[model samples]
Target: MLRKSLGALCAVLMCFSGLASAAEVPSEIKIGTLYASSGNYAGVSMAQYSGLKIWVDQKNAEGGVFVKPFNRKIPVQLVAYDDQSNTATAATLYNQLITQDKVDILAADFGSVLTSVAVPIARDHHMLLIDQTGSGATFFSKDNPYIVLTSLPMSSVWPKHVTAFLTREGPKLGIKRVALLYATNDFNGTQAAALRDAIKATNGAVELVYDNGVPTNTTSYTVTINTIAATDPDAVVALGYVNNDIAFLRNLQDSGTRFKWLFTIYPGLETEAVEKNVGAKGLEHVFTYLPSSVMAYKPEFGLSLSEFRAAWDARFPDGKVEFGFNSVAGYTTGLVLEKALAATDSLDQLALRKAIVGLSGKLKTIDGTFELDEATGAQIGETQPLGQIELDEHGHLRFVTVYPPELATGKPVYPAP
Candidate 1:
């Protein structure tokens, strides 16, 4: 009779322990982030924000996301604030999210400029920053474990295919002289610097005849175009945000001065916005980084490209925000977070980072192969292949992957008429 009593007591104690562990699980995961509703980053920021919201909504409808630490699915509450595209505002809000809101996860806004301020802040707070598209090379370093770029490759790596095209194929196409123009911000500036260094390393295989950095807000490019025209560059590479590209393309078209080859970032990244601003004629024959928005990378997780686009259109029927690469980037961020939460042993910041690191080479999503440089937490996979835009017979725009022979969909129309 005493032995039976002892067994009952032991069973009761185990049940209580299990109850205590179950009680420790929070009702919801708080994901705090910033978004720009106004200013230069607004368009891209909102699109990315929308994509993330779609993920959150989809997961909530399916009874929330599975979180391994709790051993149960927990609904996510996205605690977001509008930074208005100001770094100062973003810094203050980032601090609020960490110190005041005490969110479980911290995510950055769009692009490098807004994300730059969050890097040091996240590090200071010992929080893991889920960087969506801030691909600035300087943002990643071996010592910083508090940040992970989920969407885009680091800016330095972005120019690999670009440099290869210029050096290997450019000379054959009579593209020896190149002109480089970029905004003086982290994202564009790093890319410009990388391209310049790569060209210089070629030892005269290809050279930059004109290279200059304009302010990110520089809207007028008439004088700049004339200056570049005087250089008689065989190719002109303009690296800037959406606004800069739109303005430059517009000015170039107005000036009736055309280079044999022209490359810009946003025509492919933010196709709808750029085409709406610059028109299809201006975008035709333009070279750009063929983003995952246009590529059909087989995803091992989450929605495929076409399915995601359909979901995007369904969610954003009014179309206030343009659908583009940044939109895909935002959704990709959520997918990474979901997978990390499912694999992490605990909600501790470093533990979360470890979970994300473990997923580096294994996670494949709509954004292509999700891999990272473990040392720096920089995204190394999901490369940006070179492509050229061409208008279809029905007057619609389409991408033609032209460089890196293996992925080439069609030959580039050199000396574009």
Candidate 2:
């Protein structure tokens, strides 16, 4: 049975070699990346690729990583494939990378659904998978040994930020009631649940005038907007992806259904896409949450953010940046893998695993110090930052912080009439 399984795995690996570069291995430090560079989520994958490329360039410039197997420093090589935004396709691509490509390490995809398939594939082949973008809580709960979640988990991502913002600005904005709208997708459902739980915890009398879920790809958001408008809530929170968020925002403006506050999830008011399409007039006082403090656009971290963004912009001059978590996900994932690799003298799979799990003992990133629980894959002590979008005098999108006063640039202005 063992022989058969090994044989099957080896066969899968060989398939990857067909298209892979025939270049000789200068050293044994090779890693694999799987993402949707085409198809539905190309925007996300391209941004991630840009960030990864920056790190790769930097590492190579520094003379690469020390590989135990090679007994010398070796440049890290990544065998990346485009999963094309299809879950099944992503799974197969990842399997080929792990079982066939024989990549020493694996990097997961950008979102929850994509990562769901990538995680198990990595575990099956005993490759250490570092997740920079996926945030579903299920990844943390599952009994997987070869996985590390490097971003803010959704289960606790938005609730606290939203609740704190509301508590601070609710009375000021005269917000007594609100509506919750979400898409019936994993991303929206997770955010909606977090918002609901937050509202409950705060003891705020914000009535959930409309608690409803819409189909994921519903084109027309007019009915949804009209329904929520009819409730006369002081605020409306739409938990959605970029498409859904933009649809609802445009629909609300077209119908002229005004609200004091418009809370959103995913690529909400903070992103360049939302700002450009929704416009300043459309989202003057909307609130959005980002997974880390970096999203606040704080000048305190200006030095670091500027350096990183400059590096990315240099490589991706086509203005193909992934606005919110995508670039951060890819950039941070590279950092995590580098850290794990540095602890060991070798590229051996088992040694790499020890370095990763060893990370659980002390989790630190440019974002902040957090820990990966040994028992649970969850990263502890990480929190999301709250932000609001408004146009600057130059008409460029500006991100203003509204929570954690130490990092906040402006106070929350709610109940916009």
Candidate 3:
């Protein structure tokens, strides 16, 4: 009889302990994000994804984010998915994150294309969006209080700095003719429109000699280069993806057609793959707008661009740095999210978003100043830094800041010398 009583008591204690553990699991901070880990976009998305993962690792190590409402610190659980670089795949994964995984916070993927898909979903779910690198202007045109951009400005203004540089500096070299080739997608289309408007900055000093919109699927730029060469513009600009940029440069090189200035949207400021594929001589004197480079340093944010690169190098020795504007966006997204979480100290979606709106000019990052137009959800404070691709004294190619006099690393080299 005594033995039977003892077994019953032991069983009751085990049931109570199991219930206690379940209660603790519900209080954790859950962060959900998706990225292209194994496709055309993987080269870029993996770098950005690493930034967020690293942040989560650091926070959890420090006992996760402190929550005032819970009256105790809670660890973070990062739930991520591989989108395979397909729009359809990303959309499906987003639904899973919302319905199946039921994550508390939703973060965006690598670039504008992928992020565009998540904007609507975040609004429908009334979830706060910690936007990564999706800077399209369309997302901000509507009412979406649950979103905050931490990297780059609206897509329409991405080329503002580079355009201003050409407008203010082009006249000195008698540059009067320009050519523009862009992809048909929203990102490139917006940039093309901005370039057209940027012409007014020159006050008729520079005119568009060639403007063309090519389909995104084009595999070769042989005919495109021949078409542009016929215009004989003083300078050439292209708004395209990595592959497009590579094709454009290759045809221009093989055809022996040269221009005074050649600037492109990607493969320069957005990714390091261009340097490897185009070779040093092919990329010399090219120009692009860098949202943030591992080359530049900003101390106010307590983030080190060089150190981040070194850490990435050490952790993933075989992985490509892919270090560029988007990589900075990835890391900065974590910083922005961390601040907002602490400011609210609650998982309530509305409270989290309110904290982000309240955090404007007050936040300075390695990427530059971060301020949002609360109404439009547009990023207004950050400005683009124009970078020139040049060979250093040691003959290694580097993106050196040239425009905006304030951020100039070296004198500008024109005509692709």
| Lowest lDDT 10-residue stretch of candidate 1 | 158-167
Show how many residue pairs clash in every candidate, following the order shown: 0, 4, 0
Q: Tens digits of per-residue lDDT for model 3 on 150-226?
A: 77677787887778877888878777789999987767888888889889666789889999999865658888888
Model 2 stretches astray by more than 4 angstroms: 1-26, 67-72, 167-173, 201-204, 266-270, 291-303, 321-324, 345-354, 357-366
Candidate 2 lDDT (Cα, whole model)?
A: 0.68
Off by over 4 Å in 1: 1-16
| Superposed model 3: Cα runs more than 4 Å off | 1-26, 200-203
Model 2 worst lDDT run, 10 consecutive residues = 294-303
Candidate 1 local lDDT, 169-264, one digit each (tens): 999999999999999999999999889998998899898999999999999999999999999999999999999999999999999998899999
Per-residue lDDT, model 1, residue 214, is: 97
Tens digit per residue, CA lDDT, model 2, 69-90: 4445578787888888889998
Model 2 residue 242 lDDT?
A: 71
Q: After superposition, how far is residue 220 of candidate 2 from its true place, in Å?
A: 2.9
RMSD of each: 1.6, 8.4, 5.5
